[model samples]
Target chain A: MPDLNQAGLTITPGTWLYRLPWIGLGIGLAGMAGSAVLAQGHLQEFLHAWLVAFLFFLSIALGGLFFVLVLFATKAGWGVSIRRLAENAMATLPIFALLFLPIAWGAGQLFSWWEGPGEDALLALKEPYLNAGFFLARAAAYFIVWSAIALWFASRSARQDDSGQHSITRRLQAASGPCLILYAFTVTFASIDWIMALDPHWYSTMFGVYFFSGCLVGIFAFLVLVMGILQEAGYVGQVIHKGHYHNLGMLLYAFMVFWAYIAFSQYFLIWYANIPEETIWYLHRMHGTWSNLSLILAVGHFGVPFFFLMSRVIKEKPRLLMAGAAWMLLMHLADIYWLVMPNVYAHGPHFGILDVAALAAVGGVFMGAFGWALRRRALIPVKDPRLPESLQLDHA
Target chain B: MAFLSPQLPSTEEYGVLGEFDSPRSLYRACSQVRDAGYSRWDAHTPFPIHGLERAMGLRDSRLAWLVLALGLGGAASAMVLQWWISVHAYPLVISGKPFYSWQAFEPETFEIGILGGALGAVFGMMAFNKLPMWYHPLFASKRFQRVTDDGFFISIEAWDPKFDVEGCQKFLREIGATHVEVVLR
Candidate 1:
């Protein structure tokens, strides 16, 4: 009943996130320096990696908000106990909304369509959807809708937890069901608008699902990493048992397979079609420096995890699970860069200072927001009627 | 009723229906009552009671019926939508394919149907269970973890025509229950 800070050593008066904005600034500066010093040809490549990493982080923060809604809508007890963790993830949404500025600022450098191809040829082709006005409008809409939902859900949940009003719980559940459906449709179209449309020449109906797979996997990885950090800090130790980890790991494993399947299917479908227009995207990726990154991703992202996560015991073991989760996190970065960087640079793969610094910048921002949200709330919904059931949950 | 029950009801609050422990014992009791032709009897557990549907004289879930009905509707809509989109909307010829290739369009339709069926099943199950429930009387109990993980329970409602609290409790205990606590109605 006392404030979380007064609950003693479990929660402190202040969160570690207050220090993160400056850290983010430092990383951004370092990344800017690296881009300046990098090879002239590789400059665009470095910029692409930096921007892509920023977008990738932004996408997770956006999708993380959606995850909270779905769990709430389903009245999913197992996840509800740990819903605070995800709420913290969603709290980063506003920062991401602010981030679209830099994206728009450097759009010409990032997306090819912004650059000169022809007076009307490229512009006319992308006219239906790719004009700057429409692009900015849709991006704004997405940000507005997403931020409103995230803030609403977080406030309602936090408020209801204190109020002990049963109707509040029901309202969230009801809202969640529809909210999840809305999330699925919006997220799908948003993916189409943002990443899929980047390569206007190529099209895959499944691209939305592909992005969804990666986002889902990325969220699971985030959950694993956050849970590990929280456990080290001595919270939710009993409430989040081995069973929750196993289920989270299982989701990670499943989504990883899904990502692989979708990635391959897109490739196989395009390859089978063998069209000049469609094949060019793969042609650009599978040759030159991009080829090695693709191969590395194929083997490392899918193959290595497939072998290690196949063992159920490893998923259940916290340390081993963290290893798997951490691997997925690294891959998520690689995957996004793979999608974006090749479009910018056709040269050899380079993990320039910018790439690493950009990652740190975004990651610091993410951690800072995440930590602040968590410290304000209970680690688990201790008053939840189903808390005991979740604590006792065991997986076969 | 610890974890499952946020608040436990007092003994005199609800007409103390009847109760049973392990699922098998509950199932046997239900079957016996069902065979003896008791009409208003139901089993309650922490989760979906395996095989208890049969003992409780329930036929296949009504959800399956809802799914079938929805699947048929979805197929019909899918056909109409595809007709409108591919045939009427753009009608652009590509790869020498027909404008109205029903077979080519069938995969998406069939998928929509199955998806609709799944939706039907979920909603039907929830409706039948009267779920999306925020709170329940059982949530009051602090010892109710076994409902989900390892425990099973069955309650015969006080509303049942044949309901008698003491008699039902005696019958439940006679059916080899480990413990029989009256489920607060």
Candidate 2:
């Protein structure tokens, strides 16, 4: 590890991360495009699968944005060393806005409301809000607002690292409070417009919080995985220790529980209320093969990780933490699958080759973009006021 | 009246108690004592000192395993209780659900599991450490009374195999212990 040098202690990662091989990314894109071409008659299924994969990556980016906002809002110190990772993750927002093109183009095939409400008076009553014009407008608004905030914070952070100005930190703190509130409102509407509107009739007030919880857990898992990779490559372990891993692990664990709590609360309320409108959503998910998927979700998403990450030693151990992180990433995919697929299949679970193709394609592009952003900046917020604290942080 | 009472015998020396001014010094002394293979010894501090536990050569408490076992047992019991009561004793369908619904039992099972874990943590900590005793040999030493204050003390028991009284006292002094006294049982 290099000592603090003339350029205000800039710490750059190896060129490998920046000059990452693109063959895999190219294969991913080709596979995804090929899937859509091969499934010509099954464009509906392709779109549905694409939505799931799209939302999966989008959630990670959104989650990263939220993390950047929260660290600033709370004036957090111990997270500064790793904040660069989050900023890089969040910088993918503009790419997601571009990725939204496919979904927007195929809106007619994907969303039932886009086709105009049938005899269902409920949808008709909600027609104004669910209309294609308003829906697209809302989506655009979400992207613009999110991209602006993410770029603002990331660029500010980058500048601060160079200038070492204290007021920039104060400026970020002041802006975070209002930005967070706007973020909440935007995500709430976005969740409704994108996923909840798929079924048209099914709705839950807790959907926004539930989705946000999942996003947070997904981001934490992504962070853990990235950190593990960096350490394995002999990049960051000198500054980060088991204590940092412990904090990261606890965050992942906490968000997992939060997701469960919101999920269970939604289920319990819908079940207890016995309302036909709400119960219909659960009924669709709970019967037949979907029932088994739901059961696996409850146990795998919450139970297994709950017990696995409970131990302090496991939380601190990099290999074990990586295992949990990989599991969480997979579980997040399963969760998104369960959320999106049940609508198209109606009868039971139906996973296709296209699903895998879409996941890989979108995942490759996302990773490529992430790598580009990561390369453009220092691996750590070198000149942050709290970088010293983050460097010396001890979990105990 | 005082002259007429029988005099008690002098208190026997238990071991040397070394007092340090700060946690760092106490931690250093504990490391030296641990390196010297003095097993029957413990460190006392006004507050928990990080790394001191490692310096004292103490293993992690087994309370976590105890709590986990009890928690799982409680969850099982809760599930069984719900199944028996709902399915066998007085079966009734509510909200069109089955007589024995696993989903319905989750909330109660979770609650009981936490209860079991909480109870296990409290009792297990006490049982593992042999705590809550009204009397101990350390209490016989008048100087030990300041343990709950700013004092940092490390006591090497006489029962230790390598507990040479003068050597231990001199070792404590060399390691920067402010005072060394022979504690009485």
Candidate 3:
């Protein structure tokens, strides 16, 4: 018989776990400041790079928030043990709201539509929607809605550990339904307002879904990497086992495929329609080094990992799964880079010092915030109604 | 007539078969037998029992690797065949596009990859389980027929290095098996 009286897996991370985030935050601040000083003459380049980095981190946090919402909305039991990590990840959404200020400030440099209603009929027509004041308002709304949902759910989850009440579970489940709808609408518009507006003249209806797929892949990969580290650190290993990692790997693999599928569908539809305005997006991307990057996205982002994660052994083995997860995180960064950078360099790929600094700056702050959130509570939802089910999960 | 002739096979024992009341008991028996270093043994149950495979010392199936390889091969073949037919064989440029279009080849490749994976999973499972045999010596025992019903059984073959008639029976009973019997060939 399985041991019933085994020690509970609640844990508080050591000082190092807390310290790493501060170190990352320090690096980020120093790096951004250094990059800002370095790019004194060309401030536009810095803005573009910062927007890319900010959106990359935001996508991950948003994805984390989405996972929490969907897990509760679906009444899932499999993720109960791991849900606190997701809640912590979700709590980082407010930081992204703060981080959006730079993007808000840099609107003129990053978006073509932000250049005012000067001559171009299309720009004039899109002005009402793409104006700076309205853009900032929409962004604020998105953040408010997101932060409220994330904090509300996370607090209830934390409270459950102390109280162990079934009503909390019922409340979360009831709230999640409308929260998911809100997420879909907000994410859809946020993608439209933020990313798609960069190439103002071009549009694809599926862009929101495309971005959504990447968000899931990014967050799932981040979860796996973080969970692996926590396990290796000898905390929560008893509660979160190979089965959890396997399930996570399966999710990562699934979203990887979904991203590919959505990406391909968008490409195919655009290519098939062949309208000059629509095709211009693909045309810009399919030329020069961008085309090569596109191919790499196909093979590296989808094909290699698809086969690698197919085996039960790889997902069951933490090191192997960690490697896959890390690679995916890099691929996700590359994916964001590919989406955002092409507007500036329209001709070819450009890997500059600013890009690295921007990533480090944004990633460090994001990590620090996420770490702060994670340290605020128990690592596992100890009193969750489904905690036993999650703890007993096996891949059989 | 002699009970057995030199040319004729002897009506000797195959091995001992034991019946357990529950999957847990059968699982315990499997573990005990596996720990005792009996290699040629198997547990049969009406439904799959979690951890029984581990208790029986079974390793993961290679079917996933086989399916992945087959799936990759299928996708590659699909892409190559489409490329050859479109670019090399026919060279028909339908829409003023490039003759070798990888984007256009994606759907076919994906479909064929899924096809290959499904085929591999089905056939590999069948091959691993050694299915569709017309008969087995175990079918000769009337009680063993209940393995398809509610019965849980462990059959240790005579070919096992540790096999002995009386000792095996005692071992099975000690491991919580309710009934024990011998089979003949």
Separate clash counts for every candidate = 18, 0, 0
lDDT by residue (tens digit), candidate 1, B6-82: 33323343333344556767778778877766665556676675556768787655676687789879978999998
Candidates 1 and 3 compared: the better one by DockQ is: 3
- lDDT string for model 2 (B56-121, tens) is 888887888999999999989999999999999999989788898787898999899889999999
**lDDT (Cα, tens digit) per residue for candidate 2, span A1-396:** 235443322324445665542644675678677776856998889888889989999999999999999999999988988889989899889888877888999999888879778887998999989999998899999999999999999999999877989899999999999999999999888888889998888999999999999899989999999988887876766577787889999999999999999999899888878899889988999878999989889999999999999898999999999999999989998998899888899878888788888887778778887877776777787778888878777754
lDDT of 3 at A67: 95
Clashing pairs in 3: none
Runs of candidate 2 exceeding 4 Å displacement:
A1-15, A21-28, A394-396, B1-11, B139-145
What is the DockQ score of candidate 1, to 2 decimals? 0.03
**What is the per-residue lDDT of model 3 for residues A146-261, given as tens digits with 9 covering 90 to 100?**
99999999999999978989999999999999999999999999999988999999888999999999999999999999898987876787788889999999999999999999
Model 2 has a DockQ score of 0.26
Q: Across residues A1-396, which tens digit of lDDT does each residue of candidate 1 receive?
A: 222332422454444434444555565556555555662576456556667777678767765776788777666767765677788788778777665665677667666676444565755677767766777788787777777888888888778666767677778777887777767776787777667667866678887788888888888888888788767766666567788888889988998988987887788677657788888888888877788888889998898997788666798998899989999988987888887766666665666666776666566666666766776677666555455656666653
For each candidate in turn, the TM-score is 0.66, 0.91, 0.90
Candidates, DockQ: 0.03, 0.26, 0.31
TM-score of chain B of 3: 0.90
Find the candidate with the highest DockQ and give its number: 3
User: Which regions of candidate 3 deviate over 4 angstroms?
Assistant: A1-14, A115-117, A124-128, B1-14, B137-149
For model 2, name the residue pairs that clash.
none
- iRMS per model in Å: 8.3, 2.8, 2.5
Error of 1 at B39 (Å): 41
